[model samples]
Target: MSNNDSIKKTIIVTVLLCIVCSVIVSAAAVLLRPAQVANKSLDFKRNILSAAGLLEPGKNVDAIFNERVVTRVVDLKTGKFTDAVDPVSYDQRRASKDPSLSTNLSADEDLAKISRREDYSVVYLIQDENEQLQKIILPVKGYGLWSTLYGFLALEADANTVVGLVFYEHAETPGLGGEVDNPVWKAKWVGKEVYDEGDVAIAIIKGSVDSSSSNAVHQVDGLSGATLTSRGVHNLLHFWLGDNGYKPFLTNLKNGEA
Candidate 1:
């Protein structure tokens, strides 16, 4: 074959390959997106129920969430409450570009660290019947030992005490830092205080809890060897719930402004 003809044939083949690959990817996305979204919503509901002490692995999470949970969204900076926007559908990477919804943070903030771009965040507020607030579940993510750890933080009605802690996604080692998901360790966080007197006081100590301590924070035994992972959780919690994080919103909730 002539060189010119050969080159033209190669170009045609390359173009065809690109088209075929694109079509396959698009088709797969179309077929899977719905199921993916449904699973995501169900998992989110399950996490919310778990944080509220209602999740049973074998039980119906959808029914429990539907019956007991009331979800609301709030502007973190202005501390103003708002109606629910679909948390699962709201994309933070896109929302961050909207100046009204996002608060400015340093280079070190988790949202800033892993984010390709910063945007407004979605906060899920869960309340029980009688209009009594049980736990304020915040969507939080941060760098862990190996990857970004995404989880929910359930703060008690006081907005300082911790009701429950659950990490629904992460990449830490299974036996060590991954213990953050273990029921035994997470259960220890049930009654802990996330802050003290407006100061961030919660910590994950390397050693055992000292009974002589007077702080309201509950002590969870750290993993036998996952020091870095434990510290990552400690720092992530302190950073996200501190001055640069959700403190403003929590303050408003405590004062009845929210």
Candidate 2:
């Protein structure tokens, strides 16, 4: 047999080909990293704008976001606005996994089912030219039936009324829990009240809300056949809006302390 066709030669060629391919792939990843990061940032900005209902279909996302949004960091424990961290550089999701940056949760306290929560969270504020808050968008995440769902919850300045809710990432089952992405279902959250008489009264009910029911304003229809996911949504919302989460911040905000 010819040397080129020999098993040893063929093995050598294959190894060399793999080495070349690996180098190319590594180089491409390194060269493209900045673009990937930029795209991810752009998508994040879009999601924030979308959650606040401030996104215009044909308008420049960056320009519009810059014109209306003010990013700030909030101390979860104090419920106060803090300048200790740079809002632009803060990485909350990463912080959650760091013991120094976050706090561990007990089973009872972790209604959202996140094992740990960051000590500080970034919030987006949509303000008028006068600097008065219009809408406040807060980040939230929790495990669904299958995977962690990350999203924004925007509220009117009162902090009790929802402006919009959108999950930017999730791995829920298609046609079931995935219905959370349905525009029609998301629309149902637009006017929902987060608090009723000083309590977190909002809920994703098992069935459709009765329009005529007195408590309908705080109820959302659960996704059919997705009970666990529905429960996770309910729990996460409550956890985020309750005393251990944004409630203190909302109080400070209303008092002009945040």
Candidate 3:
């Protein structure tokens, strides 16, 4: 056989092909990163709009978001708005992992099962044409049955009534835990009250909410056959709305101090 047809030559050719493929893939990834980041940011803003019921079909997400939403950073400890961090670039999830920017939670204090909580959170505000607050969308996350569920919870101007909710990311049993994505289940969140006399009264039950019950306004039907995921949702909501979470900030918002 010719030297070019030898096994050594074949191996050299194969190695060269692999190296070329790798280099091409690396270059493509580098070139596409900016677009990827932009798309991700757009998707997130779209999710925020959808959570607040502001998303319209066939409309430009970026234009509608910029026109209707204002972003602010809140000090979780003081429940007050702060300029310490740039609201536009601050990332709560990333901050939560930083020791200086977050606090470690004890078992009893961490109902959401998130080990560390960020000191400040980025909150989105929807306003009327007259500049009055219409809705406040807060980002929340916690451990679910198999993965962490990240989502937004939008409250009305009163800060007690639910406007809407939508999870942007999660991995759970498709028919069970993943039912959180179901429109019927999500619609149930609308108009529910998050507080009863300064207490976080919201809950997720094993079955459907009883409209006739006095407590119905605070209760939501749990995900069928996904008790843990349902419980996680309840816990995360509780944590985010409680003292260690956005409660202080929300109080400030209610008092017009935020």
Candidate 4:
């Protein structure tokens, strides 16, 4: 064969190899998608359970989730339960970018610095054996120092007292802002009050919380050496727990209307 003929053959072989590799990758992705989704869902449920203090080692997440957790959709502005949307299929983060499902936030209302806020959100409910609601887990997210942090905040039935807070995803400097995921810091939020007399009062302080302070109930010790990240957490908590987030739903819950 001439040099040109050999080059053509080589080119054809390379093209065919590329095509085959692409097909294999695409097929693998399609085949693995369902399992990926199931695992993602399981992880999410496990986080919700953990936030509610219900997760146990060696327990089946799906079984425990089915037995104890109920998912509900809430209209953020009205604070009312709505059956209009399916909780299991709704994506709050995606909705925030969809004009019809979200709204632009004014500067004053956007403490978390999220430009748009979803109108509806999914809330997880944990109930006791008698079916009495024990805790409500609300999904929360906001920009931290370097990246957005996504987490679950669990509150007592009263809707004001925090049961637990956990950030499952974030990109921040390790040992600093990333400390938001630190178990010890998260534990500080367990008993903190999110609201004081109907106002969003909970704050992440710059230093250790003063136990003797009158507002101790509303304060959480900030992540040391990560002031920006701490402020991000504080602002996001206030924004979510405030009127722009879940305040309406919580208010209705308090009034026995939800």
Candidate 5:
């Protein structure tokens, strides 16, 4: 073949090789996507049940979630019962336009780290015999050591005291900030009151609680060397539970709305 013809042949070969690789990758992704989704859903259900103090690992979560958990969407402003919406499908970025999901945030609401405008947040209301609500669980997500931490916070009927707090996902350092996931440490959060007479009272202290005060704030000692991670959790908790967080919704729940 002539020089130009040989060059052309080489270019054609390279192009074909690239196309074949791309097609193979695309096919593999398509084949694996469903399994990835299933695994994610199964793990999410497990974590949610764990946060609700219902399930242990290696246990069946689907049956328990179906039997004990009731999920709902609410108007944040009115704090009343509303139509059901899927939390997984809700677009937090486009939530401003959802007429039923009332909020003070305008169309220009900051699309920050977490999607603020979710059509509906996942709320797990646990029940007991006589069909009465026992624990009210709400999802909490905010910035952590290196990324946003997503977890669950279960509150007592009073809406002020926390019943349990558990972190399901976070990217903090393993030996330091990641201690937020430690069961022994998180257990301290149980029975901790979030606020004291309209003021934010909950805190993660650097050391042990004094043990002298009758009503000392719930204190989780900071990881010895993880200042940033500790600070991140502190800030996020305050931000999420404040007036802008779930304060309004929780207050209404306390008032016997939903």
Candidate 6:
């Protein structure tokens, strides 16, 4: 073949190869998208179950989740459930970034230091066979020592007592800030009172909680050697449970107004 003819042939082959590769990639993405979404949803349900202390060893997460948990969307400001948003498809993190769906936080009100906050949030409800609400799980996130920590805080129906707490995502030092995941540390949160006289009063103390102290009901033992992470937990709890967070929803629920 002449040099010019050979060059043209080479270019055509390269272009065809690129086109074929792109088609394959596009097809794969389309085919796998549903599974990806399902898995993401399953993982989220698992986290919710874990926070509610309903997760069991070797159990099917989907089955247990569907049987035990009910998902609902709440308006933070109004403290009311609204059918305007679908709980199954609502993405709180994504909504927080949307200008129309979120509100900017002031420095004083931003205890979690989350500058932008979503106006609506998803809450998980667990009820007994009688359909009486037993527990409510709230999603919470805040900045930790190295990165933001995202977690779920489960409360008893009374609204002030904690049932369980779990951090599903974070980027903190292993064995230090990472100790937040320690089952023992998490256990300390159980039965801790989150509110005092209608105020958010829970605190992740600097060290061990003093059981004899008057404020012991609102205190949980801090993560050993993870002061920053512990403080992040404290701030996030206060932020999410306070007036700007779910306080209105919780108040309504407590008053039977919800």
- TM-score for each candidate, following the candidate numbering: 0.79, 0.97, 0.97, 0.96, 0.80, 0.89
Tens digits of per-residue lDDT for model 5, 130-242? 77777888777667669877788888767777788788888989988888888887878888888888766778777677767665655656766787777777766775576
Candidate 1 error regions (>4 Å)? 1-29, 83-88, 93-104, 107-119, 216-218
Quick one: ranking by TM-score, best first? 3, 2, 4, 6, 5, 1
Cα lDDT tens digits for candidate 2, 166-250: 9999999999999999999999999999999889999999999999999999999999999999999999999999888999999
lDDT of 1: 0.74
TM-score winner between candidates 3 and 5: 3
lDDT of 4 by residue, 1-258 (tens): 699999999999999999999999999999999999999989989999989999999999999999999899998878999987888778888999999999999998898888999989999988888988789999998888998889999999989889999888899999999888788888898889988888889988878999999999999998889999999988898899887888889889878887
Candidate 6 at 96: error in angstroms? 0.7
Q: Model 5 lDDT vs. the true structure?
A: 0.72
* Pairs that clash in candidate 6: none
lDDT of 3 by residue, 76-181 (tens): 8788888999987888889999999999999999999989999998999999999999999999999999999999999999999999989999998899999999
**How accurate locally is residue 73 in candidate 5, as Cα lDDT from 0 to 100?**
69
| Error in Å for residue 194 of model 6 | 0.5
lDDT of 6 by residue, 49-106 (tens): 9889999989999999989998889988799888778887788899999989999999
Clashes of each: 5, 0, 2, 0, 1, 0
Candidate 4 or 6, higher lDDT?
6
Model 1 clash pairs are 95-119, 95-120, 96-118, 96-119, 96-120
Looking at model 4, residue 130 earns an lDDT score of 92
> Candidate 4: TM-score?
0.96
Per-residue lDDT value at 255 in model 3: 90
